[model samples]
Structure formats: C-alpha cells, structure tokens
Target chain A: MIRDKLCAGTALGRRIADSRDRLYRVALAWCGDEMLADDLVQETIETGILKSRQLKDENRLYSWLYRILKNAWYASLRKNKGHETLDEELLADEAGPFSNCQQLEIVVQVRQAIGRLPAEQRQVISLVDLDGLPYCEVAEALEIPIGTVMSRLHRARKGLLGKMTTAPSGAMTANRILHLVE
Target chain B: MENTEYSLDDQTLGSFVDGMLDAAHSETVIRAMDQDQDVRERVHQLHLVKDLMKVGFGHTKAPSAHSKKTRLATWRLFSPRIAASVAALFVVFAAGMLSQPYVNGQPGFPGEMLAAFSPVLSDSDNVILHISESDPQQFAAALLYAEKFLQEHRSQGYQVDVVAHAGGLDVMRADVSPLKLQMIEMLSRYDNVHFVGCANAIRVLREKGINPPIIAGVSTKDTAFDHIVGRLTSGSWKYIRVDSLVDNPGSA
Candidate 1:
C-alpha cells in the first residue's frame, strides 16, 4: 500500500514539475508580479495534485493544468488589495529581451509598455501568442469559446502593435522582436 | 495588377498559416497569396509578430528557493496516507482475481472483459469508417459494407466519412487508380461520405521529389493517428482495420 502511494505521488510530482515552468509563465503573465505569480503557481500545482484523480483523460493534462493555473491567478487577484507596487528594477530583471540591456532607459520603456496593456489583453496575448498554444487549447485553458479566443487574440495583437510602434526606436526594435514571435 | 478581392479572411488566413485549411481551399489561398503583394505582406507581418512574441517571453527558469522547500514539505506530509490507500486497493484487486474460477485452463473471464477500455470511451448509434490505405480489395469490401449500412440508416440520417490518408492517398488520386475513380463516382452519389488526405504528408512527399497526384479531398489538420484517436474517443468514428474488415466481414 505504501509503495503504491509512493508511486502515485511520484507520478503526480513529475507531472507538476514538467508543467511548472509553463504554469509559472502563465501566472506571471496574468498577475504581472513575480511573488504573486509564484504563489499562484504553487497553489495551482497543489490543487492539481490533490484533484489529479478527478482527471479522467490523461491526454488532456496540459489543458487541465492550464485551467487550474488560470483559476489560481484569478483567485489570487481577487484576494490582493488593488495592484501591488511592483519594484521596477526587479520587474525589469524578470522581463525577457531587456535583461541584458545595460541602458536603464530601454528597460524601463519596455517594462512600461507591457504594464500599460489592459489585463485581459495581456493575459490572452501571453497565453496564445507568447506561449504558442493552439486556438482550441487556449480556449480550453481560458474556459472560453474558440470565437472568443480569436477575438481576444485579435484585440491583443492590435493593442500591442499600437504600443510597440509608438515607443522609442530602441524599445521598438526590442518590441518588434518580441511581438513578432508572439 | 488585377484587383481581385481575396475571400481569405483573418480566420482563414490564421488557419492557413497554422496549416488547418483543407487541401483544395489551401491551394486556392496559396495561389492567391502568391499573386497578391498585400496578402504576402500580411503573412510576413504575422510571422514577424510571432517571432517577437517568442523573444519577449524569455526562457522558463527553474523554480525559486521558497517554492522548492514548500513542495518538499507538502510531499513529506501527504506521502504516507496515499501509500496506504494504494496498497489496500492492490491487495483487494489481487485477491478478487485469484478467487475467480478457472475454465478451459484459462481464467473464466467473459469475452467483454478482454476489450481494452479507452480513456474517453463512448458509444454511437452509427459508425464512421475512416479508410486511408491503397489496398483495392479492402477498399471495395469497406465500400460495400458502408453502402449497405448507409442504405439502412438513410432514413435515420446516420453519417459516415471514409477519410483516406498517406499511402491511401492513391485511393483518391485523380489519375492512378481506376478503382479509386469508381469509388469516387459511387461516393459522389452519397451525401455522407468524406475522403481526406494528410497535407503534411503530401508536403513531405513533395520535398522528397514525389509528385503523387493530390487526393480529391480535404487534408486533415493533424496526423492520421491523432485524428483517429480523437474520433474514436469522441465516439464519432470506429476503426475498421482493413485486414480485419476484409477477412471477417461477417464478424465485423
């Protein structure tokens, strides 16, 4: 009995570890705070493990995990008192593409552009474009219909394009690289 | 430049880029894109947007120190209880199996027990047979059975789609197979038959310098295996292994 429990636990642990990075990225993208993202990710993993038995189809694990992470992000957001004062330097450190920028000006602008995005657009763009999830899978993760996914993605792309084009040349170049991939 | 309004909307363009468009439709879109500068520019911009997004997201690093410790502590507390439950279930299952009587020197389990249980198993009032092989005899038998079945279900509105993929591409190839020609002619009269090929497979074939005639059907978005699995799980389709279908038509 002990051996069986250990085996189940190990299997669950491995799945959580395999999905940790993506879940953390999603959480970070949704919440925009490293500490809160971490907390959300941890809560998601814990909840997923406890409810793993409820998952009937193993093939849907990725979508199921994404759903859990989405729920946790929303729950954490509701519990928090307004937007937390995010440390700009620390956030810049966490931001990709700007991590190596020794020029503080470029990093600040890039971070600001990301921060300026409406929360809904930011989350949709992050999951679909940044994460590269297929439209169907993104719909499953967000608990929205495929049409909603398409509309949100379209809006997010429009918003991001507007921001990137208007930013300074240096930030635009960096953002062009970032936005193109998304 | 001749002004021709492209019918390919954003959804279709996205689907085309994602390789989700059916073959005939994709061919039409590709030809249009080649002829139109605006279409080409839009595609290029979309590609650029995708690349920029990848760079912006950054690499996924390992978990932080605090998270690692919390995970370890949680595991330590929960492991024992889970272990006990698993062991108890295993023991009960083993005991039940052992207590069963033997028949004909084999375990007296019913025939139904032998069939595997799929994770997303379901039942259907009608079955759709997806055929994607080049065997003429097998194809003929499948068609005969499907036709008879359709005749019975015609009033009830039962649907069946016979999708041909990969080597089965020859089954729907315009020029190669006379049997394919006859099958297509017969299927054209039926409202519920669908024949498809894998577009990715055709692309791979083209890259290898093989100009196998394009099948006269839509290409599946994913691999044949994924499509089959999805259909079977959803209970919309059932696999009739060509060999099994032909060899034991009465049984199937």
Candidate 2:
C-alpha cells in the first residue's frame, strides 16, 4: 500500500534519478574512473529501487540510499579484487579526452587527491564535507559510530591539507563580522 | 563560571570547522579563536579543504551521457517478477500519456532541451542520438558513444539513430564532419545505426548560399523534430540531444 508509491512515480523513482549526479560525483571521487563511477551510480540506483521497502522513513531515504551505495561499492571491490584490470581508461578515452583541462585543473587535482585517500577516510570526508551530511547522518549512512566518523574526517583533512590546501599567511579574518559598539 | 577554556586538538578544530561542536565546546573554540592565530589559520585551512572538496567534486562531470547507457536493470536482469512490474508500469505510463497532449519533452517522455530523453531508464530497446551543435569534439564523442553502444548491445540489436539539425547539421556534412571516416566506418559496421541530416537545417544553410554536401551512407530527413516524434510515437525509442560530453544526469 504505502510502500507501493516508492516504485511508481514522483517519489522514489524520480528521487533515485535525481541522486544520480551526486552519486556519480561521490563515486568518481571514490574510484577516480569515470566509467567505474558510472557503473557504481547505476548499481546504486538499481539497488535503491530494489530495496525501497527497507526505507522505513521517507525522511531518511537519502541516508538509506547512501548506505546501500556504500555497501554496493564494497561488494564491487570484493568481487573485482583479483579480476583482470583491462584498461577501461583507454576505452573511456575513446570518447575523447577532456579538452577543458585548464578549467578543470583544481577540480581534477582535488578529486585525484580524494581518490588517493584510504577508502574509509575518503568515504567519511566525502559524506561529511562533499555531500554536506551531518555526522549522525553520515554515521548512519556509513554504518559507523559517530566517533569513527570524526576521527576519519580528521585524518582525511590531514591527508588533503598537504596535497590541496595552501597555508597563506594573512591577518586573521573573522569567521563572522563582529561590530564593536560604544 | 567553570573555566570552559581547554586546549584545542586537530579533531576538535575539524569538528568546529564542520559545525559538529557541542555548545560549550563550540564556545570554548570561539573564545580561543580570538586569541590564537594558529587556531584561526587551522580553521581557515580546514574550511579551505572543505570548500575545495565541494568545488572539485562540484564541477566534476562524466564524459558522455553515461546515464543513457543500457541502464543497470540488473534487478530486472534477475527477477522476472520485478521486470514484469517495470514493464507493466511503463505500459500504464505510456497509456496515461496518450490521452494527454503529446509534448515532445513531456513528463513521461522526459528530456531537457539538450539532454538525454530517457531519464526513467525505461525498457526501450533503441535510442535516437541527436546533435545540432557544430562542435567537432562533441560530434566525435557522440559518434564514439553511439558505436560503443552498438558494440555492447549488438546482440540485443538495438537501433540507434544520429539526428543532426540546425548547427548540428555540420556533423553529417562531408566536408565539415571531423569524424567522417569514423562515421562512415560506424555506418558500415552497424546496419541498425542510422545517421540523419535535417533538411530544415540544410535549408537554413542553403539560404546563406552554403550548400553543404552530406557524407555518404548518411540519410536526409525533413526535420529532426519530425523524425524524433515519429520514431518516439511508433516505438520504444529514447531521444538523446548531444550537446556536451558531460553525463547529463537530468531527468528530462
């Protein structure tokens, strides 16, 4: 009855479609391969549709979907551990190399850096920062305790700082502008 | 007041930057921020890391319309019960739409002006690849994707049509097409693949005294829209508007 709507129209189906891009972005950062990211996103959407009944609260659908995605990602890694790694990168390049490298340099570097992090750390930082999920929601999504989420986030930030961020010395700027009154 | 002042660790500062700090701890960090330049800088750098993560991933795009691939109906691949359900759902959706005004890019036929038409990941066995942009790289990418699709679904015998209209007409033009040899090769290889040039586009070009010759093995159509609507109404065909190499995750 109520669960039936999740399959049909404006609810779960459309929502799954809407989540594809962000999922691809997260998947890309995780795997660093566009083709694999596409496969991951597709798998996530399918799994989301198949397991819609497991989603008890519509409000928590995103977290549930992400959890499913994380699980699927792990499963894929397990499944492909010893498989022949044909250069899908070569096949992907047949579609033409990215011509806008200059425009995408910083973005590519950040993505590559994220790709370089340990899987657990990458997952936490992406869920927390890239996806803007709260610690609780990220914990729920990753199926980890909140403490683990914080620690992984700290490690991920430390990993990224040396590679991506610059320590520009400047006068301290206020996080918020505070006015002094007489 | 109990001295809420405490030493700040990297994790606490990271939490503070992420707004994960509890009230008392947050206040402590805020108070300390006024006194410690290093903490301020660490917080700023943490913020920069977060912002770069957002930006880098924010602007990251897939090469080509990956969503339009033979969708992961892996669930459908396994369970006939669910495949039946999806099939039945499509039947109902198509039936429901027939009674309404048939807009080209309507809800059931979801596609943006320059995005893939098959957002719902339907059971459609074929697609019409479209291009109206004169960009050479774009044309090559679309052709490459179309051929890859043909190779993958060769057994399924999927029908693919490349329709070029307006500025997209250049892709099918003999002298202009950057991928003329590749297009010709693909045309020979996949009998089910159709490459179309819009006469309406040719007329516009002709009006400017530029009568472009279309490549051999390609066909001419009256207008891209007519061909699109005709194929869509007649069969299970998705229309893909090839504007960029980016995987357009748009529903329409």
Candidate 3:
C-alpha cells in the first residue's frame, strides 16, 4: 500500500542527525544556558518526530524543526512569567581569574550582551551570526520575512556595538582583553 | 594610535568591508585611507571590533554529543499505538487501496478525500512573503497593498503580516526613498504589519559600516519563500502579488 511506502520513508533518523546542532544552538541562544538549551533541543526533537506527519515536504525538515523549537521557546517563556534578568555574577570578573583568559571573559560579556537584546533580535542574531545560517534560511526557520531578519540582525549588532563600546576598559580583565586580541 | 576621520558614512564603510563596492568606489576609499590617518585608524578599529565579536559569539558547542542520552529517553516514551500511527502512514502507500475513495464533485483520491473530510483540520492563517527585488517603487507599492488589505480585513478578524526580505529590505531603510519612508511610517500604524530585513544582509551591510535601523519584523527563515509558495498553492492563505493588488484589486 502507498501508506506502507510512506511509513518506510519516515526521515526521522536523518532529520535528527542533520538538525541536532542547529536545534542545540537555537535552544542555547533562547535559554542563555547550556543545560536548558539541551533540554529544549531534546524536547524539540521529540515534538518534531511526533509532528513529522504534518511536515508534508520532507525537504523542509530543518525549517519544520525550527518552527517546533520557536514554538517551544515561546511556550516555555510564557509559562515562566515572561523574561528574566541575566545573572550579572556570571559575567562579572573574578580576582586574578586566569590570566590569558581573555577569551572566556569576552565570551561571557558577549553572552551577557546578547541576553540584553530583545527576544526577537536575540533569536535572529543567534540563528544568523552565531549559527551561520543564510539569511533566507534564517527567515524560514524564524517564520518571518527576510526583511525582518535583516532588521533584527542590524539591531542586535548595533546593540552589541553599543554594549562593547561603552563597557569599561579595566572592567574587562586581562584575560578578556587577550580574548579580544587573539 | 590615531582616531580615523573621513567623510564616508558607516554604511559606505560597511559596504566597503562587505566587498559590495565597485572598483571605482573601492579605489576612492583606498585612496582616502592612504591620505587620512584617522580614516585608516577607524577602519582598523572596526576590523578589530568585528573580529572580537565573532570570536566571542561563534564558539558554540556541538549539540549531538550532548543530546544523545535525552533523545534515547524520549524515544522510549512513545506508546506502541502512537508509534504505530507515526510509522503506519508510510506503510499505507505500499498497501494498495486500503480505504474507499469518495466522490466530491470530482472523484477524490484517497489522500485528498481524507484531507478534506478530516475532523481535526486547523486553519493556517499565517502569510509570509519574500521580497528579493530591489526596486523601491515596487516595494513601496507592495507595502501599500498590504496596508490596504490588512486595514480591510483586520476588523473581519483576519491577521495579515507583511515581511520584506533581501533587496526588498531597502524600502524599510530610513534613507532609501521618500515614498519608502512614507510606506514604512504608514505600515507601522498597523500593529499586524511586521517589517523584517535579513540578518545576513545586515551582517554584509554592517561589515561595510552601514547602520540601518532594524525593522520590527520576523527574522528571515531559510527556504521560507518555498514554504510561502507551498502555502499559497495549498490555498492556506491568499498570496497576492503587489502589482496584481494594485492593478486588479478585486482578484487580489
């Protein structure tokens, strides 16, 4: 039967393998934490599988998965009583915190800066800048028009520039300084 | 370390960095950099800043290694019936004509009839457009049509969102054209009309030092144009060409 043929072609295995990284990165960006991102990615994958039948075109597996991720992010955010402030301590420099640790510090600051962005801007930057998806692809995943993607990316970059330009020089620590240089 | 000063705006510089400039323009920037210490320093600073940001943000850990355990656990949770349902449809095509075909005016194929008669159908109201052309007039006209359509339909409880992607984003830029400026202003009045530009475009633009305002629209989804086309073909939502809307309002 045609149905049996369709069943055999269930692309769940391939879809999971291809989207694992993208889903993880999206989750990480949304939650701004590693463990949560992992959990979200897992949840997204499971949901993607359950809803695979709804995905009429298997070629669009990644976009379909991303839609599920976006939905999950929103649902989680809503249930959590909207936005939460980023923990400054995670970003603050510690005494003599690993000299030549500029990379770690810069990473922290960047993450903090990203956290400061509006949810939509953050999502856009994460998918395009961090994940390195093409603009068209990012548009598909976000389910927005490409123009919106460009706008959000612009805002996010501008926000980053503002944050970095204004951040105190000494407050960055030597490690953070080296991180920027290297 | 001298600060860079030059007449070129950030967007122009950004375009230069993005390699979007033609030879003559690039020659001009290169000559300016040679003659102006401040401009040179500024360009250097911009490069440094971009590198720093890329380093800070680009280091994402691989997801597959971390998610393997959780995926297995979740896979175990599927009930046999549910799993069968998920796995069964694929098998239906292999088995010949398991369900009776019903006549709906035209003889309905099994799948088509089932889709039509399905009790759990949900309405797809989302409309996403891809505007890749760069003509500001066409872009503005599209926005005008979208505004009119949304205005007419919102009270009828319809949700319409207009998003411009790629070259179409020029219309949303503050400096593009007077017509575009008015389009952006008027389009913003409707809470439902979302204007978005592509991030890749922004990155390319920003690298050249252009600072365009971020439009309040959804970020671009890859291959989303195809998705929109698919939806239009399926009668999910009416997809109107901007020109068609202007020329043939009744059909659009």
Please state the Cα-based DockQ of model 2 relative to the true two-chain complex: 0.13
TM-score of 2: 0.49
Worst 10 residues of 3 chain A by lDDT: A88-97
For model 1, the superposed segments whose C-alpha errors exceed 4 Å read A1-12, A84-91, A95-112, A168-170, A173-182, B1-8, B66-252
Cα lDDT listed for each candidate: 0.52, 0.61, 0.50
lDDT of 3 by residue, B1-252 (tens): 112242235435544654546899889889989999977865665454455445554445433453434432111010000000112222333453223223343222344322321111112343433455566434534543454455455665454544454566575666663344444454556666655555556566678899777543344433324333223323334333333222232220
Per-residue CA lDDT of candidate 2, range B151-198, in tens?
Answer: 567788888888887778888888877667667767766789899888
Give TM-scores for every candidate, taking all chains together and pairing residue i with residue i.
Answer: 0.48, 0.49, 0.42
TM-score for chain B of all predictions: 0.45, 0.50, 0.39
Per-candidate iRMSD: 20.3, 15.5, 19.2
Summarize candidate 2's per-residue lDDT along A1-182 as a digit string, tens digits: 22244556647667776687778767766655555666777778777887777778888877887888788777877887663132111111111122222222334345545656778888888887888888888899999898888878877887776544331121111221011000
Model 1: per-residue lDDT, tens digit, B69-160?
54321100000000000112223234443233343564332222112111111123344444556665445444444555565567765566
DockQ, per-model, please? 0.06, 0.13, 0.07
Model 1 C-alpha lDDT versus the unseen true structure: 0.52
Span of ten consecutive residues with least summed lDDT in model 2 chain B: B76-85
| Clash pairs detected, candidate 2 | B64-B245, B111-B252, B112-B252, B132-B168
